[model samples]
Target: MKQCLHFLHTALFARAEELLAKRIIDGDPLAYFLQGQLYFEEGWYDEALAQFEKIKEMDFQALYQLGVMYYDGLGTKEDPEKGVEYMKIIINSNSPKARHLKYAAAYNLGRSYFEGCGVKHSDKEAERLWIIAADHGNPKASVKAQSTLGMFYSTSNPKDLKKAFFWHSEACGNGSLESQGILGVMYLYGQGIRQNTKAALECLKEAAERGNIYAQGHLVEYYYKRKFYTKAAAFARRIAENDNIDMLAKITDCLPVYIAKGVAMATFYLARCLQLGVGIQQDQAAAKNYYSRVSVSLQVHSVLLLVLPIDWINKFVSICRR
Candidate 1:
């Protein structure tokens, strides 16, 4: 019965694909959108770009896809300026077809302003755009803007912890994995929220179980602080050595900037454990290697020029001195 169902599903999917291809030949914009999304998900960036560009004038969704592809340099030379322009076009639009996409485009535009990718760095502009997106938050798709608002508030000059907490809570409730981990930290630190150790642990554990690398990093710190060196070592070992510099370089699109901090924390904690022989079998030489890598990661990932948390380098200085 299972095999029959699987076969039926496959047959149905193939038929749909055939119809989609036919519609593409017929110049159906929606068909091009569907096919382009399929290609995007499958990592066929060039084909996806081609399909989206074909319907760019007719669909805001296709324009969004084109912006993302150019922004990420998936199928073309990295052109953040062009991507930013595309997003801006969507935001200025009043077409009903663009209503659903305005929030997404605003969020991406905010990021560009924040990072100075195509525009001069402007926290004011970033906040404005993020607010536009966050105001339109929903269970689907708007969580990123919500979570980003939380991050922005947390780091804003004179920091609005209350706003940060509120946004993170909203994002977490809406099923944002990143916000879930951040909520744990806020709870643990009593940052704009009451301290609740039990809630903190539960939130961190749940987020970690769901494969949130950010939560995993903090979990390592939590265990290490509690003297659960074995568990900390086990987790930090995996996180610290998980080398995906390529992804790290281009991580700005969908991930929080704090992700670099998380990776660095895990690496630092792992190095500390190795130096002291606290958990895993330690080699002083290997510890030194990780220690050096921490600094290198702080410098750059070499692809998209992402610097892994240089702000936390002071934490490693004492360890290096020893």
Candidate 2:
């Protein structure tokens, strides 16, 4: 029975439901809980509430879930006060059964305090509860707590950037995608730790591979600036093919003479790739258009020099020919 219940909670729902049906027919209380969870997942909140209500002696898990339903108005009218009361009861209880329920309850109650849902808005109180919940062995709550702490320390006034770095790094390690991207940027600029270009590239690349768009953009710029034209073109092509015209325009615009020479080289390489179908599809018309624009700009510069002294024009012509 315990193993079946564990399976249900651990998300082997189909198998758990099949096994739980027989136990529920036998009027097992744990089976009621499992059935209630399945019903809740299926959005049959009324049926779930009926099943949960059948457990006359509610354990912490049942009580916590009931509180959640009330607070969210899932199967009943919204009653924040009632939800808060139920959560408080679980927090104050020393019951050995379903002890893990405290982490979820505490996390939810902390959010209520944070948002002034049912309780008065109190950041300190919310932080306290989050700390407790985070320490209670819940991975979700722990990630939330670490992410919140990272943001809290990331302020600029009395900069606790080192602590911010630590929290974000820890959160990233714990699978927080936002933290991974933020930490990558931080490493790039040496916000708290020493700037390590290699480490920053590695971190941003990892995040980009995991579908972080911001990291992808940064990688495009990084490779372009470093004269890694092939890599820059690849990343830029991804953004362009995804229909991000603004970003593609930004990549192309980097070729202006006033910008770094490496940027121009990268842009030219990208245009060539698009033109020749090197790594991406051939777009000869688009390539010709870009090349024409570059030529027009250089011609404009040459025409401007035509107004200069005859000696300067001769020298400029000589330089252009060379």
Candidate 3:
């Protein structure tokens, strides 16, 4: 039985199925559960339900799936009330097998309450259930619960910002991309924790690597501000590849005006990338055009400083040349 389960875990589905078939012939309940899971994945919900129902003593996980099927109208009529009842049973169960099931059951029941699905809508009740699930040692439920709590406390009093920070931090540690991005912003601004630019950059970089678009945007700005042109250009090119009209407009507009340091630097880095072909195809003509604009701006700034001492003017010109 353990070998069969190991095979299933390793994705040797054919051998696992054959082993499960033999176990089912021998009336093994665990085999029925495993077979039901396979059928469910295959979208043969009717067969899955049949196998699940044949177990004389259904474990909480199997029961939870039955509840999901009823609620989702898979091989059964939509019956949210019945679904709620089954979920409650798992939550109330004392069996050690109910350990993980309880977390899922609590989360699902919380959603039911929050959405008024077979239950009265009650924000307080929903929050309570989610908290229970969060403390139940399931990473997925913990992420959901922490994210909800973080958002809830974020809009409250200053005192609650700390609470929000704690929840977001917890979720971020659990690999929640949204929480990671939010935590990065929080750290950047010192919202709930001490301002730590290094920490903020690390969090934003991790989130960006995980495909968080908001984090990517922040990282692009961060690298640009620090004059890490190569890094900034790489990120900017990625964003440009996405072809977001609003973002492209923002990037391009920065080139003609000194609206913000980060934006201006990003524009400069992008132009430099075009010039040097660093992480992008080089276009000398386009690069020269951008460089001309920069040179003109510097020349105008030097003219403004002409009223200064001769030494100052010479120093300024030398700086510009460099």
Per-residue lDDT tens digits of candidate 1, residues 78-138? 9998899999999999899998998899999999999999879999999999888888456
Off by over 4 Å in 3: 1-12, 72-78, 136-141, 155-159, 221-233, 236-322
lDDT of each: 0.82, 0.65, 0.68
Give the per-residue lDDT digits (tens) of candidate 2, residues 1-322.
9998887766766667788998978877778787888889888899888877777257566778888998999999998877887888877778877466677677778878877988898877887887776663345555766655565566534667897888778767778665676678789989889998888888878876775555665666577667666677786655433333335335532112222222222334455566667656788877665445434433544433322236533533453343
The sequence of per-residue lDDT tens digits that candidate 3 reaches over residues 1-322 is 9998887766876777899999989988688889889989878899888877776266666788988888778988899998889889989988898877777788788878877988788877987987897784346665677666676677544447787888888877776776787788789979889999889988978876765555665666667667676777877665534424345335432111122222223344566677778656798776665555445544543432322235533643453364
Where model 1 places Cα greater than 4 Å from the true spot, the runs are 1-17, 25-29, 77-81, 245-257, 280-283, 301-315
TM-score, candidate number 1: 0.80
Q: Give per-residue lDDT, candidate 2, residue 274.
A: 66
The candidate scoring highest on TM-score is 1
Evaluated against the true structure, the overall lDDT of model 2 is 0.65
List candidate 2 segments past 4 Å from native.
1-18, 76-79, 136-141, 155-159, 224-322
Question: Which candidate, 1 or 2, has the higher TM-score?
Answer: 1
Work out the TM-score per prediction: 0.80, 0.60, 0.63
